[model samples]
Target: MRKSSFMRISKSISLIIFLFVCNNLQAQNQSYSTNSKSDFWRNVQFGGGLGLGFGSGYTDISITPSAIYNFDQYFSLGLGAQYTYIKQKNNYASNLYGGSIIGLFNPINEIQLSVELEELRVNINLDGSNSNSQDFWNTGLFLGAGYRSGNVTIGARYNVLQDDSKNVYSDAFMPFVRVYF
Candidate 1:
């Protein structure tokens, strides 16, 4: 046989082996799913955050909703959406909308590690004038470790993309809470 023919045969064998391994792993996963009694809703979580603030000539409101899926005892993935509105005296206002992805890892009881990636569209009127509004996108990544008890999780995360001027967050460190249902 020619060198090219031998090479072709080797590539074909490698492809077959890769496909076989993938098929085997997928079959095992399917078996686990079929053997489990819990339905889809039983393995899912829903929770988020809400905020309201009122002060001198200013008011703020925020709402976030999230859903998560528990793949197993060790790891979970989630998605969330956020909306915030801020209004001040003299027609000043800002509106923000965004979405985020969350990942959690639990190595032991009551301890958790988390990472989040988010993007937001910020519309702001810097001088309280509706005629001069600006819009921009803000992206952030946060990493945290926390303790969980029952349905509540409390943790502190640091924003990896925090900027002194452009970012809206006052500081890099922020606290979070999650209630799963």
Candidate 2:
């Protein structure tokens, strides 16, 4: 009789635990469903900031600001401007204009694939005594994917560039971070 009583108590406890777990899981599922019902890209957000670019034998610290317009749940456009300080003892600098297209896909939430193009005005001071500067134009294209959480975005990209006039300054891979408010 005692054994039978203990078994009854155990079964009751098991049933209670199962019901509690099921209730919690159902609540979680409902919350997720409600959030997923809204179109993710209806809101347009704009932001910009500073960054550092490090590459082979050169490191560039920069300020970059961007404006983004989200059209729907899948596609967006971004436009940005950047100024970079090239630390080559003589303070070589460049100003850049950037544009990009962002596409959002599933399997990874809040992640986007981006394609970008940049036009840069690069200046170099050939001599320390010369007040005059040599100016050149460079253009770049990039393909990458990004993950965003709240106001922060992080990504990796492969970049290609060419100086149209001189046929110089090739391409490289770069990683980046962006924030939006």
Candidate 3:
């Protein structure tokens, strides 16, 4: 009877150990599967802005390219590079190049709030010849809000650093569009 009781106890302990090991393996497999779904490239977005404007004797063209990483469904961070050219009737032309750091927050399904910090190099050619030019740096902070639909976003921003005496833009309001893929 003593030997029978010992065998029964040993069998029960072995069953419990086997069950514990199986459960742990299953949990590890689930964790790995979840991580694989959100790989690095899967969370990346690519898009930018293209702008063209023409008036009586003025022309403006701009191109910007950007990349963003989605930290989750509600937040994203991005970086962008910009190039712009402007020509006026009076033989005044300007070339602007810059880079920006962007942040976005989505508090609801269709609303987005954005902020951008930018550093730009401005080259102004007083003569149409382009040989006589001046170079300077301009920095701006822009605050914006927009509506997003599908892969497109439309927004308007106001520049916090706009100064009529020193800044290139006489107006502080700018409109923008962004597409994502």
- Best by the lDDT measure: 1
In candidate 3, stretches whose alpha carbon ends up further than 4 angstroms from where it belongs are 1-38, 55-57, 128-132
Residue ranges of candidate 1 with Cα displaced over 4 Å: 1-38, 127-132
Q: Give the TM-score of candidate 2.
A: 0.56
What's the candidate order when arranged by decreasing TM-score?
A: 1, 3, 2
Candidate 2: tens digits of C-alpha lDDT, residues 2-84:
99999999999999999999999999999987776554444657777776777765666767777776666566676777676
Deviation from truth (RMSD, Å), model 1: 10.1
In order of appearance, the predictions have TM-scores of 0.75, 0.56, 0.73
- Local distance difference test scores for all models: 0.89, 0.66, 0.88
Give me the overall lDDT of model 2.
Answer: 0.66
Query: In candidate 1, where is summed lDDT lowest over 10 consecutive residues?
Result: 125-134
**How far out, in Å, is residue 162 in model 3?**
1.4
Per-residue lDDT over 44-78 for candidate 1, one digit per residue giving the tens place of the 0 to 100 score: 99999899999999999999999999989889899
- Model 3 Cα lDDT, one tens digit per residue, 1-181: 6989989998999999999999999999988887877686799999998889999999999999999888998899999999999998888889999999999888886988889998999989886576667788989899999999877889898999887765578788998787878
Indicate the worst ten consecutive residues by lDDT in candidate 2. 98-107
Error of 1 at 10 (Å): 54
Question: Which consecutive 10 residues in model 3 have the weakest lDDT in total?
Answer: 125-134
lDDT of 1: 0.89
